[model samples]
Target: MQAYRIVRDDLTQPAVLALLQFHLDEMNRWSPADKVHAMAAERLRAPDVTFFSAWDGAALASVGALRDLGAGRGELKSMRSAPDYRGRGAGRAMLDRLLDEARARGMTWLGLETGRPQAFRDAHALYAANGFAECAPFGDYVSDDFSLCMERGL
Candidate 1:
């Protein structure tokens, strides 16, 4: 695995914005609009959300965020790896950073809502490998055909 420098991002950099847009576009392409749960750049800038980007030297490799859901709970948001960075451990590195941040913040659980389509198969496997399991709808989400919710104890 290549070394990745993971750090908190303000979501204002052009590369970060572009990657986030790509992530939203891909999510929309793979799932219905109503079922798409990826947050926009503005939403990710909220005080409770800590956005992170992983870089390989000067190039942005991946992006993710952890949102405080209150009561010792947190949620993973906007996880995406650049096309050239996929399969290169950048995403996993970003996930590890987010999990570490969650634990540091005293979160007892971390959950995420992702697509159920085949396009998201790899994402499911990655989350599962990291100890997340399919769980009931969480937060404002409800049981849905196109959404898969997963959670892990911190």
Candidate 2:
């Protein structure tokens, strides 16, 4: 599989939106008020956000975003793999590419907020496997039982 990092407009609108909505639907199954859908949509339209898509042949396998927080800090936002692509390491591959891009841009730290509900156990394990450690909340997120904050210093 090859991964592509493209300008926002380079993405096919329906495909990208479908990926985002799928993630939102998955999250909503557990946390109804996560509000990540709106936030991701807004960020996807922002110039400061870098979005990447991983493709297997011509099929979109995963999507991930990295937002510049200024001062050498970056935030990971809206990372998900298509349902048919799960369990195939697409998420991990996409995350590794995002990390490389962030470091290339001179980011000193990477932070992300993820759901902490039982439904998110696999996600939590993914982050932990990549060296992200639990940390205090970052970005616009407040401390909540349903969410967790994690960071990895570059």
Can you tell me which runs of candidate 2 are displaced by over 4 Å? Answer: 1-9, 34-38
Each candidate's TM vs. the true structure? 0.97, 0.87
Q: What value of lDDT does candidate 2 attain over all alpha carbons?
A: 0.79
* Each prediction's whole-model lDDT (CA): 0.93, 0.79
**Clashes in candidate 1: how many?**
0
Supply the TM-score for candidate 2: 0.87
Per-residue lDDT for 1-154 in model 1, tens only?
7899998999999999999999999888888878888899999999999999999999999999999999999999999999999999998999999999999989999999988878999899999999999999987887677888999999
By TM-score, who's the top model here? 1
Cα error, candidate 2, residue 38 (Å): 6.0
